[model samples]
Target: MMDLMEESRPDTPLALRGGTRSGDHEKITVNLGFVDLGHVDLLVSEGVYANRSDFIRTAIRNQIERHADITRQSVARNPIEVGLRRYGRAELESARAAGTRLDIRVLGLAVIADDVPADLASAAIASIEVLGSLQASPAVKRVLADRLL
Candidate 1:
């Protein structure tokens, strides 16, 4: 794993590159049981939350706060990228040209831009281990299927 403090780059701000949200956050889908859905609706109707998303976000934040220490330790140990990360064709091409390989480890989201080709991705990226989500073209995914974790 990379050292979190040493390898961290402030320039790489986490932003969902191609997501619907205008903010840096990425949109995600979650499935809930009927009872859980009803409870969320109840909370919204009772004015505890403006909407289901508000309640869910709050709940997730609370949970993360509750496990802050563990989360921090894990992040440090794994040295994974915490926000949104996007890789474009030019980036991959440059890596390939420089004979550099990528061992991608992301805790949030990692996206390979649509313009990137499968061969370029395969040549540049050696491995991938994403804890949250990965967004890549089908051909790229298939080419790197063995390297994904």
Candidate 2:
């Protein structure tokens, strides 16, 4: 049961602002198609993102920044967070070495491949900033909860 007042707050576990955190403020409204949104929504379903808005906001930002020659602002954007399942240990370690850990929060329930077990996910949890992955499966959730919730 979603509260009408929480229209802006989707029932997903994760949510992120469009740009880097700077205590900024801006607002705009535009309609996007369902097909495009479905693709983004898949990421949300896969436990890789928090909600529809997070995926759409990131997608729109990427599409806009793709025309970087004119905007000249792409250089400041954070690296993308897609393709999360394929990430290797070395890559995670490299990012962990950086002063600030990245956010890999997922929302709702999620299913990880059987081949990949909770132990591995447990290790990965240490390398992130916020680990709000409600989507993690029972076993994976148990492994990661110590670091996240």
Candidate 3:
């Protein structure tokens, strides 16, 4: 599984998937006003927060927690998976055999296994709406690009 931990670059043909600890984190940059930055700095200096990043993370977590019920309701209504979801070759083949295509909706990482071919992916997947990230071969991504939301 260590071999699947390769980081993805925009220039690379490969995409990322879940395997290592770092796969759980998707780095994001935040912009803040000077006053807010100073406030965060003061909190850090006062030992209320370890750092700006920590403070931001905590704030984000708190907001998410506060809106947990709403999030749950939305997820339930949309039929979306909240975490890591992988669609493998066998699963797609089975769906194809059943004459059913999947409309994948995920709030987190959605992985199409590396072994899944572009044609199979295109045939088996009707549409994809992912709120976070998607992991698939470049070919599969291209074939499904028109169906992605």
Candidate 4:
């Protein structure tokens, strides 16, 4: 692939999947207050911290580490997936009884179980004779029919 960084503009969004590496650092410039500068200088002079940079770096690092897990989980659990994982054949029946729809997006080709099972899907398709609307692969339709049958 081309260099995404070169193509991306300054307004492009940046997401840290794994919170960045310790060795990979970027340069930044900041203004410091007189009191803060004096405190940093004193800390460096006392050998408690290497310098102001060290203190600031540690604070930024702590913030990143604190929010990394939250970021990863938030990325993983989608609204659609969340609803699907809690639904199945009986749930679909309940939904219909309550006058709700079971409309779905397959996302990709797969035989994995969730939302709608292969057996239920095949039954629905055969009953309605409209598997075309499901937009599922041919092989998957066979699997659904076979399992349901």
Q: What C-alpha lDDT values do all the predictions have?
A: 0.78, 0.46, 0.80, 0.44
lDDT of 1 at 71: 88
TM-score, model 1 to reference: 0.73
Worst 10 residues of 3 by lDDT: 1-10
Q: Which candidate is the best by lDDT?
A: 3
What is the alpha-carbon lDDT for the whole of candidate 3?
0.80
Query: TM per model?
Result: 0.73, 0.29, 0.79, 0.31
Candidates' RMSD to native: 12.4, 13.9, 7.9, 15.3
Ranking of candidates on lDDT, top first: 3, 1, 2, 4
Candidate 3 vs candidate 4: the TM-score winner is 3
Regions more than 4 Å wrong, model 1: 1-35
- Candidate 4 weakest lDDT stretch, 10 residues: 1-10
- Please, what are the lDDT tens digits per residue for candidate 1 over residues 36-139? 66787899899999877678788989998999999899988878888889999998999999999999998777999999999999999999998877788899
lDDT (10s digit) by residue, model 2, range 1-149:
11111125344323343222222222233343456556666887998878765665566679967886644443235332322334344554555456434345332122344444565666545633222123334786576665653
What's the distance in Å from true for residue 72, model 2? 4.0
Estimate candidate 2's alpha-carbon lDDT, on a 0 to 1 scale: 0.46
Give the per-residue lDDT digits (tens) of candidate 4, residues 1-149: 01101113333332122322232233343445556556767887999877556766777779969998874575477322221122345765565566654444222122223555554554333221221123344554565553331
